[model samples]
Target chain A: MNPASPAIDTESVTALLERGRTLATPVLRAAVDRLAPPMDTVAAYHFGWIDAEGNPSSGDSGKAVRPALALLSAEAAGAAPEVGIPGAVAVELVHNFSLLHDDLMDGDEQRRHRDTVWKVHGPAQAILVGDALFALANEILLELGTVDAGRATRRLTLATRKLIDGQAQDISYEHRERVTVEECLEMEGNKTGALLACAVSIGAVLGGADDRTADTLEKYGYHLGLAFQAVDDVLGIWGDPDATGKRPWSDLRQRKKSLPVVAALAAGGPASERLAQILAADAQKSETEIADFTEEEFASRAALIEEAGGREWTSQEARRQHATAIAALDEIEMPEKVRAQLVALADFVVVRER
Target chain B: MNPASPAIDTESVTALLERGRTLATPVLRAAVDRLAPPMDTVAAYHFGWIDAEGNPSSGDSGKAVRPALALLSAEAAGAAPEVGIPGAVAVELVHNFSLLHDDLMDGDEQRRHRDTVWKVHGPAQAILVGDALFALANEILLELGTVDAGRATRRLTLATRKLIDGQAQDISYEHRERVTVEECLEMEGNKTGALLACAVSIGAVLGGADDRTADTLEKYGYHLGLAFQAVDDVLGIWGDPDATGKRPWSDLRQRKKSLPVVAALAAGGPASERLAQILAADAQKSETEIADFTEEEFASRAALIEEAGGREWTSQEARRQHATAIAALDEIEMPEKVRAQLVALADFVVVRER
Candidate 1:
């Protein structure tokens, strides 16, 4: 490696993330604990802090990527990370709330290598706990008592609305035979991009950044979110199950209208045609028929997707988004250290294996 | 019946309620319409503005009671009703969100003489649309762009949390063998009173009422909410199905631990013991056994509750709460005409047949 390549300081970024998570997790847990019990219990279980029986459990809480972004963005906007703590907590709460409900809606049985909230506690409890967490996010923000509390709330609310709309669109796409790549991208933007953008912009607003700087930071986060999701889509299909914590080819097996699948369908090559035939056959099968489908059949379909250039296109899209995100960061005139950290975060988001 | 007595002007109160509902329904519908389809379709159906197939319908939208309370509180706090429009819309949206989720949770098939959103649209859609409406409520409140928006959002968030807690407790009670009247009332306060109190207090806050007046008005709504729930419990068991639009003896059939039933169990008469035996027998029975339990059996249990003085106790409690509600209003020092209308609204709440 060159002595000075301008690459992200991976060690420093990791330390910053760890520090932010350590500070934010307890505040997030405390907010969840404030909920009325049974709900508190369900929320704790969802956050991997407790078992379903309300006993303590050493379980995995997903890497606090959103909270880290919020804290980092605050520092980039010229304030201490502490000034962004409330924003960090709010983003984490909203993220978990979406996960809890999304798991129930999608009938996902496992997440983060454990039984999901709905699988362990039932759908009603999951729904209620999700609601409690969403309300808790707003409550924590209002308790900030800062001048930007209202603006922060408005931002979160709008993002939440878009998030719901995006999920709704994703669900609707499942019933359609064809979905455009543009429509798929719009859905991804709403489902993932809105919240990430809100997280960074909220931190900037809380840290007293001017409107232009905050807006630029939001653009950076938005493109980063898109790049992050594109990479996630890649990992969803081809990444090792042990690393991704998902079933191998789960999106393909579920016939989800993910980015690669949509792009493959749009590619219209011979391989794309064969891939469409396989998916349609899978869709028409009964439960027993689907159960009888061999892993070899799944492998061939994945091969067809790659041969059709879907995987290549998705990787290229991720890199394109990553480049755009970095360009947006150039519009904001922050300190050199902060700019490097931001660029490193963007790079990590697009390039991570899982 | 005395002409000289200062009885409530029910006619004027009804006119005020109709006016409030008329003004607020469009805003509420517009908000629901803003949701993406089929969520928009599901929301419209839930609002009783259309059929499941998207055709227009003349269905009941409940009494619009909460919105009326908001607008009236604004007027009583020395502002025009239009000043409370946002508050009214927020309360109504929250109320509908709860209804949507509660119907799904409770597995109720019918509401307001029509099928529920969950029954027609499925639970996932119902849950999503309910979530959308909830987010929309916060969005509308924040859109007010007033100095009081943050405070209003806080009040609504707290009330919504309590409301969810109360519902969680209500579901938990269904699994328990016995519940105390005090516990039941506390649950009722959280479930019903919190939102009502929020409605009145929010209207006062928006109308620029001073703290003492707003506090007093909240107290008034809180007591009124208790009275309203007590009355609803009575009607749940004894009101005409044609009038109430619920199954005959619905609460008794479901073995709900409503206020009257709890009070009767606490009363500890032979009738109470007999009623407990019947419910226990029903609970222990198989599905087929319960199905064979006849309508005559349900009526006999209702008779047993009356013979135990439960119905009489509930009615007396309703009157007691009604008096306390009126007394709270007396401390507010509002105009004579407005106070009369407030009292009338309280009277209508406690004395309504449906």
Candidate 2:
């Protein structure tokens, strides 16, 4: 709550995101359709546009946040949002591709209130479909036939490499008894920030923004991604299951080494010591023995995480990142309305209940 | 096998391939090392440079056939082989990426006489490393900083899509009672032909070849790929295990509906009927029952496949396609020495024992 900060109108940002999703859906669909049959069918299911049986579905794809950022960045860079449709489609495809692969790697059976692609189709198909979507993203970028294609492709490719690196680190962390907060943050930056930065900067590049402005927008996105992940960490323990479409205390149940958990463990308080003991004991248990945690046990673990100041530290960090993102926007000389939209989006990212 | 065709020089072509492998090895190793550790280790092991425990070991990495084709195509198109290093690197990376994923999907435990990546490093790391290599391929192409970056990326992306499509079809065919010979051929074209075509044409494009010449080179590659796959099918059935690094009748034991099997099924003879009966009987067996197939049964099955003229049809087709590949090269007006090299390479592809 800084008094000097600009007011964020969440309603307008929501509407803008809706518009971006509508604008990008057909383009994304066409790009996906270019894949071979079963893979295309599998991708369609992953996108929430169809059921596993090939029937139409009314399932929800998430907020289309990355594509919205791309279109909005294009607008902020002095071009019509239509000019950014290709960028928007590419980002959305990449996002879905990551989701498909991550679900398989993490052994997640469900996503967005539905069975995951791997669970429905199989791991082999999921991997292939993820790969196909990634290739389609590149295909869409090249087919855009713009002068910025090379720049856009290079940026996206680098981001993808970093994203894979982040996933690898995340998997490796699961095997360790402890992970430092700094390492966790670095992983989050690569896992989440790299793609979001690409999403924002790619639009600017395509919209003909100068180098300085593009870099500034990329910074804004990077910080925004950090803020988003921080809030997500808090929600993983405390958010309503109905809101998140996840089991209660999902991350805690899985002993995920997310930011808040790492922070709590590093705090060196009585609560932190108890939390570490609980985690170590759980780790030592066989898979059959570890499955018997009661609701009360989960609730107490969440309370301990908060008692260790993990919640406070994470909340403060999220606010800091949000503020930093908005400050970066101030460095970019864009139209006032577009700047307002960007600020609102940043605010929505950190402040959303879900 | 045609007497009127150019004489094949196997020794020189073998030496040229070895030279290409030496040049591309360091670059491929460096690019793969750029992946996150453990993933890098997995990739290195997959490339046969190290053992599973990360110790250096001598392991064969196939023929580096695709990279050699890329370099030779560059030479044929009037550029130094060095000019096509990036293209060679990219093709080789894509090839290895496919191998990694394919090993996982096919449940193949062994490759190049060693444990497959998924078997040694786990499926998650194998998938991630495969993705990293694919991203690296795109990175190398863009880093080429050539005017052909977009074209090269597009060609590679399209080839990747077809490769996935072909694999999807291959998997789906396993569930079907019969697959047409033409359908089998088309799948082979997509699975194997597309990447080989990309390997040849990307080199020509990078070498500043005219569009017509590039198209001709692509055609040569396409036919060469079909011939190569046909020969591979033959080897899968009857090639010596000591030379092929696989069990004799490996494809038959797995009941793989490879081109020869499909052609035999379509031929509708007594041996074909008997082969079909054995396959159906095998399909009906439980896992434990299936595992009881004796070496004598495998031998009998291979004998039956030959009796159906499957082996003969596939061999004749391979030679015909090899001839077609040489004919396509005749349409390109390259220097005599380069033409001879290419013809030699194509002949060697069909004639290799392993």
Candidate 3:
């Protein structure tokens, strides 16, 4: 509502994220080193610190978005970025914890352009490592042993509960034939928004920001997370399989009720009707049949969804959320530098390619 | 190490456990009620508060032994049992969280005379709900907003980490052809001992006991956990399927590297050699072959383990650990009644039939 924005540059955002990874890595590694063998090895591999054979290597870990947000939020609260290291590492651990479990539960076999933890170590190991990381997140925060540390932990636990509840909703929605856009957004809020919101707020909490200030930061991050997921949903359907490193129409193949699919179905047009009919037929089939559906089957559904304006709707929604996230930054009194970094991240997350 | 023990009555121990459940159930339910939709239903079902059809039905939710220990530990610290409710619920939640995941990881279909959560709700819900419970446990402790709550939470996280580590070790041991008595016990200590240790001590910490008293109580609980698990291993191989609600020779069928199996292998006899050869051969088979193994195959291995003194060794080990646990109780100063109750629990855990 306030800004006539200049074009956001990408290099500054990349450098900020790189800075986050650099600062948080040593602490994160030291924590993982405390883990015993097998878990240590597996976690290292998942973080792209080692090759599959357990030798040192380098690969894509992630963009370090949450860590960057945490650090920036701390600075926003008038503390050094270093004050947010625990918050940064804690959120990163949680993000990966969810990923390990989510991959196994969703039956996806690859992540970060490599075989997933479950695919390589098996589902049991995936579950164990994920649980361990979640425990470690709380441990890191509480090890600080400050009143603020306990306050941040309470926020984290709440976010984690919401994150888990969202996963259940996501799974349940896959089986149901009908889902409204509102319901889909609510699920996304719980699934992705909660953690990102916590990422922004917990750092402030850790930096001794009062609840009101932290709450404002949380609002910014929540909208940013939705924007992030909206872009992901669009990419899941229309992005290049080679570039995205996923099967074509991956979400449709899995019958995932992502934003685009749900929005398309709710469009109430001829293409939407056909899409619903086909999805219903697919639902009635056995698990094997649904799993073995041809490439053409999913590709056709993607086309129908596009014809019903799902893709256009989702892209627009992402932009809207991105703008709302920026507006949220105005509600809090932050250094212009910190707000600029936050805005850069929001813009990058909404539009960045894989 | 301690005076000659008086005979402990089963009724008193049962009454203690029942009291623990009665005092902790409402708080546990209130915490669980905070979870959203399908998760709430799934968790309720897992706790035996509801039947498979979501109907209300009372069923076995396990012994509530940890809760009993927690409440009693608070009493030992000269606080009322109500002071331990948070510790009691937290440990119970962690206990059930492990069970839900372990049932899926170990592929066990039933527990406490009912189908396991994973078997009924699908593997995904099991993972998600288990995660929710773990988060909820931390939330319960931290919500008190007291320094003791933070202290208790730290202990709980450590126990939870060790618990996850134990699960990994347990899974890995099953794949190995040979496991020493020492290794098996180490794994059991991690898997079972850590949480029990936390349960007994966290309540005291919550009740404002000093570290020395909590440490002594922790030692007692650790031995008790090992004793409890030793009994469980014995039952897994030799107890009646009807009483235990498990398949015949359940541990052998699953090729579990339990104390009995390892002890028999370490016994170094003709039967032990045969058991090792059989297990090695079975390990080389495909997953389907292992899954389809006949009753006779498992029964034969059980017979070999028993003949090689595995079963007898485990039983004696249970008694030894139980005695050690009782001795540890003498290390701490407490009311005679609390010590007697602890003694009774130790006595019952070591020798009770399924």
Candidate 4:
């Protein structure tokens, strides 16, 4: 590979994501506008479209990665990117819907450098607004009155059920004393991979692509989601505080049994033993003790995980998943530009800093 | 109507409801069975098909009113009852979904003579299982692979959104000092009427009924819902505790701004003024004060509302809505037996004991 490819891919992916967001934003806004006052207002605040006082704000709304993949998937099926707007809008809505509920369930107060919906509007509003967005996603898709619209809606609903299953598993796992690596992967596959797989394939489904092409696209997306999550897990422990908008060792502070930690626990080493002891203490500590823990304590736990080869194992798994995601693209022929953009997005996901 | 009609209608409606439950139960169970463990178990418990220990128990599931409406609607549209199974399952799922969430949001511990979902499982499980049931409702509708399936899905989604809006409004109203009569009715229309409206019409939609027929049937269900809610409000204040399984003046105990209370507040007179003062005192009291208040105190408030004509007005309104609901059937052609069953169900709703 050429040495300059990283710079070129970064620029290309940024343009692609921006273009996808540009196309999908109006459509998303239109559907959200269909909601009544308080729900619409809360949704607007959650989406970074407004402040707590209902004034317009320019806050960040994430990377638009899922939307970009949706648009490109439509293009991959030899349709205009416009064909994927419903897919884009549906996914973004579902993504934010999950974020809203998960935040409340996780007891999080801040997100995107602002107070969360529950913190600002209250938990009831958060639940209702999240439900409203989910209903809107289906309303938008089924209104198309086409066979493809029906199929796409079905796919999205199944993915959403799987997503809920993943959350249930995640919550249950947190309370248990031990979680296997296989169990963790199964949960993440359902939680993260299912929705992304639907996002990428739903566009092709809407574009009237055959089952084989949609299936291949889903493979690409499923692997991409795993890779993205692996990177997120690594960042959760060691990412720069400024870039991530989180405290140092945020995941450890929350007692998250993320992929890296699960893998380290499975490795069976001296460092793994030490890490388990710290985690056992974490599990037994009261709320006050957990809150009183210092960064150095978390850092030492992070260091133990690294010594156990967890960081390396997780990084290699991300690269492996990334390679598999790119390989799925080779199974089907598509426009060269679309292929390039998909590849660029995959690279960006695997290597993103935050 | 003939002198013998009430007895015959009561027996016939009982037979019809039993039939609808028998038909829809397997389909509902199958859809719920598709959910993963814990969620599936929680849903089963919510349906009264199982006990808290996961053992099968004959707990009371509501009367399955929505399912009966869907089946009758399909018969009204000249289709076999089997064609409406999807509609029956979807509405039942959605109804229970709302119940699960509402129980949590309302902070009620008891429902249908047993512990609520949140009381049985934690709040997080309540939230997740409720979410899963909602998703399952859509999945059941869209899997039928027909044009009517698409239309029915669209209708159900809109109704779900309205139901959520009603829940949001209900929560907000609980904190406010006063709620207008019209506001209370509007909220009930969305919360209770919208889903019932969809339940009655969705089956006909699945059977390819015309828009006029669907709309008229919706009118029937909407009015029936109001009648049902009015009866409910009346029972909340004055029903027999042994039959209703609730204390006398239960609505007042919870500070509910139900239809009777709102109407009583709106009527201007000495009794109305006294009722308002009592309500004002009730709202300002602490939890301990509320719990310590004697039954006679609540009984006095009830007496004031009755003297202000709130009880009589609500009963008259129930009759009016019941008449309106039965009248809607005249606008469309249907079998005589189907129409009779529909009328019977409407009568049952307005006069149910619990």
True contacts kept of 2: 0.67
Q: Per-residue alpha-carbon lDDT of model 4 for B181-241, expressed as tens digits?
A: 8999898889999999999999899999988999999999999998888989999999887
Clashing pairs in 4: none
lDDT of 1 at A348: 72
Docking class of 3: medium
DockQ of 4: 0.78
* Candidate 2 CAPRI level: medium
Rate residue A54 of model 3 by lDDT.
89
Reference contacts preserved by each model = 0.65, 0.67, 0.79, 0.67
- lDDT-based ranking: 3, 4, 2, 1
Between the candidate structures 3 and 4, which one is better when assessed by DockQ? 3
TM-score of chain B of each: 0.95, 0.96, 0.96, 0.96
Query: Candidate 3 residues A1-354, lDDT tens each?
Result: 222332566888989898898999999999888787789999998899998898898888887899999999899999999999999999989988999999999999887779999999889989989999999999999999898999899999999988998898889888788989999999999999999999999888999999999989999999999998998899898888777777777787778888998998999889999888988888788768866877777778889999999998998888888888889889879899899889888878877666
Which one is best on DockQ? 3
Off by over 4 Å in 2: A1-6, B1-6
Stretch of 10 with least lDDT, candidate 3 chain A: A1-10
Model 1: per-residue Cα lDDT over B99-174, one tens digit each: 9888888878889888999899888898889889889998998877665777778888888998899999999998
lDDT of 1 by residue, A256-318 (tens): 888998899899979999998888877777756755668897788889989988898888888
Question: What lDDT would each prediction earn against the true structure?
Answer: 0.84, 0.85, 0.89, 0.87
**Consecutive 10-residue window with the lowest summed lDDT within model 4 chain B:** B1-10
RMSD of each: 2.4, 1.7, 2.5, 2.0
User: Which stretches of model 4 miss by more than 4 angstroms?
Assistant: A1-8, B2-8
Candidate that beats the other on TM-score, 2 or 3, i.e. the better one: 2
